[model samples]
Each structure stands twice: as C-alpha cells, then as structure tokens.
Target: MAEEPMHSLARRFVDAWNSRDTAGLDALFHPDFRWHIAVTDHGDPEMRPLNSRLLHGMNLPWGKAIYNKKETIDIFSGIFAASEQFSLDLRTVIASGDRAALELVGDAVNPANGRRYDNLYCYVLHERDGQLVLLREYQDTLLLFDVWVAQ
Candidate 1:
C-alpha cells in the first residue's frame, strides 16, 4: 500500500455519502463495521453505542425527508465528517487509514424555539478492500431528535 492519503480516503467517503447513493455510500463502508451515537453531553462518558453505517443507511426515511443532500466533509486522516443533516453538510473533516475516525461539532439551532443545540460527534471507521465499509460514532441523539422532528 502507498499509505493512502487521508484526504483521498476522506473525500471518497464524503462524496459518496452526500450523494446519498445507497450503493455508492455502501461502497465506502466496511461490510462488518459498527457505529455509535451519544446524545446528551458531548463528552458524556456513558452512553449507548449504535452501528455507524448500518443505522444511517437503514434509515430510508431520511432520503425522503431531505430535499437535497447538500453537505461537505473536509477530508483529513483516520477520520471523516459523518455530521450531516439529511445528507446535507455530508462533507466532514475526517481521518483515514487502518482506523478512520470523524468528529462532528456543531450547533443545531431550532428556529421554532431559537435554541442553539450543542452537539459533538465522532465516527470511528473501518475499511474493507481499501475502502471505508464500516463506522462507529458518538453524538447527541437528544439534540438529533429535536433537530430531526423539527425537519
């Protein structure tokens, strides 16, 4: 291996995800990968874990809910931005290689209540055949629910 650049690895996943091409997105994930979502305190030490790609991919409703997947994942190394809204902002700064990881930091401002939600997310990724095929992330699900229901 030529020690694939983190930017390349990150972009590969970001491009595919923003496109929301299930097949294309699937292409980036490891077959047996997992992810986690932590909702509450961004640094909440104790939280439930969730499957990365599988959970997100399995949500067919998002595709319908989202009018356009306009997002950006700035690539890095060992990680990628899994922080996107309905595929929007799919572009995430990530890290790649043996242990790809992505951290998403943002505020979900609910227009209804004018509440800016604080959130933090991390995606621990795994690759198959030189491609990211799995992911595990930690995020604020409560904020996610608030943001989601608002949409």
Candidate 2:
C-alpha cells in the first residue's frame, strides 16, 4: 500500500486525541517528540520571553510544555482523567511536505467543576518518517486560565 499523505496524517493526529487513544498517540509521535506553547504576556512587566526548552517539565497553573513522547502521553492522560468529555473539532488543515498546520476547536467538560472548557487552537507540526517530531500550540491563554481556575 502507498503511504498516507501528510495531511491525512495530521487529521489522524486529531482523531487520536478525540478518541483519547493513548496507544494510537504513542505510535504517531516520534521518540523525541516535543510539544510547545507560546506564552502570552499575562500583564506582568517582569515576564520575559521563555525559551521552549527551558519550559519543558516545568508545571504551570494552566499546563506545562513537554518534551518526548512519554511526557506528551502523560499530559493527555491527565486531561482525559480530569474531563468527562474531551474532543477536538478540526476546522482546517494545511500541509506542505513534512509540515502541517491545524486549526482546531477543543471542547471539554471538567468533571470537578462542571464547567465547559472550550478554546480555539492552532497546532504547527513537523513530521519525520510518518511520526510527529514537534508540535507548537497556540491558544487563548486567558480562556485556559479561566477554565483551570474554575476547576
């Protein structure tokens, strides 16, 4: 069989998340997979641009940037554990060679607070050998903060 195209691989990535299939995710991510979030200015004058490498393994109230496939799996596991319903709605996907960008709407209901967690996200991905090697995520930090605090 011919290999799947990059765009199809990107869609499968979201489908794996929506299904909360950890094993599926494990297969999709490269061994060195890294996930990054662009931190927005939270009105703190002292806050500076953070290096993505430095953010890995450091926990924040909202979430943590993660490195490696294991760490990524752990984060997803935690999210699924906390939310009764978690799903990603893919709005658009664009792929060029080994890179892809996805626009998504994430919806989840936190069981602890009974609050809806809804946010838009853009994920930029790099794939190597049919596995995702890097993912940069951009989302509404304020919305994330609100949902987290409510929970």
Candidate 3:
C-alpha cells in the first residue's frame, strides 16, 4: 500500500491523542519508536537532565518518567482518566518525503487541581515504512512548569 501523506499522518496523530486511542497510535508508530523532548532551562533545575536525553512518555515533573510504548500509553491513559476534557488543535503542518513538522496547541483541565493546562507544541516526525519511527517534540518548558509545577 502507498504511504499516507505526512500531513495526513500528522492529523491522524492528533486524532489519536484527542481520542486517547492506544491502538491507533500503535498502528501509526513503528514497533521501536523513539520520542525526544528538547528540555529547556526553567522550572526546578532538578527537572533538567544532567546530560542530553531521549525518552518516552510526557515526562511531566509530577510523574515518573516512562520510556516505551506501553508506558507512553499508560501515561496518556492516566491523563485522560484525570481530565474533564482533553483536546489538541493542530495549527500547521509541513511535510516533505518521510518527515513532517506539526504545530499544535493543547488544552485540558486536570481534575486533580481543577487547573487548566494549555500549551503550544511542535512535533518533528520521521516515518519509515509508513509508520512513525522517531518523534522530536519541542514545547515551552517554562509554561509546563507554570501549569504542572508552580500551581
């Protein structure tokens, strides 16, 4: 089968997040997927890694780090479980060959704090055999700290 266009794949990726569909994500990601977050200076210095890092899961300061597909699914499951509503709005997507970059904004209310969590994110995805093999995610770490840590 021909591969789906990268932009279309990116849309489906957002859909998977909005729906909290693990199976859909499994279908889209390669068996050995790797996700990287570009950590920044902000929040407690404790949260920053001593060195560069590549990890799975959302890696929010409040939770333990998760490092694989199953763990990632579990993390999202917990997020959905605690949220009254979770949504991701895709602002733009640019693709070429097997790579794509997506700009998005996410909004949700965590039942634990009744605080709204909203942030902008950029995802750089690399695909192989029509499946996402690598995802590099960039976001405002300070905003994350404000929402998930500062309280």
Best-fitting candidate, scored by lDDT: 2
lDDT of 3 by residue, 1-151 (tens): 7655898789888999898887898788787765655453322223444333533333566332224566665666777787857899999998899999999998987666667778899988888888887777788876775566554
All candidates' lDDT scores? Answer: 0.46, 0.76, 0.72
Q: Pick the candidate with the highest TM-score.
A: 2
Q: How close is candidate 1 to the true structure, as a TM-score?
A: 0.47
Per-residue lDDT of 46-119 in model 2, one digit per residue for the tens?
Answer: 32333468454433453344445797798889888888678999998888899988999999876766777789
My TM-score estimates for the predictions, one after another, are 0.47, 0.80, 0.77
Candidate 1 local lDDT, 53-112, one digit each (tens): 645423211212111111111121101223333232333555545665666564445555
Candidate 2: C-alpha RMSD to true structure equals: 6.6
Q: Which of the two, 2 or 3, has more lDDT?
A: 2
Residue 79 error, candidate 2, Å:
0.6
Task: Give candidate 1 regions above 4 Å deviation.
Answer: 1-6, 38-85, 88-97, 105-120, 149-151
What does the lDDT read for residue 37 in candidate 3?
A: 58
**After superposition on all CA atoms, what RMSD does each candidate show versus the true structure?**
11.2, 6.6, 6.6
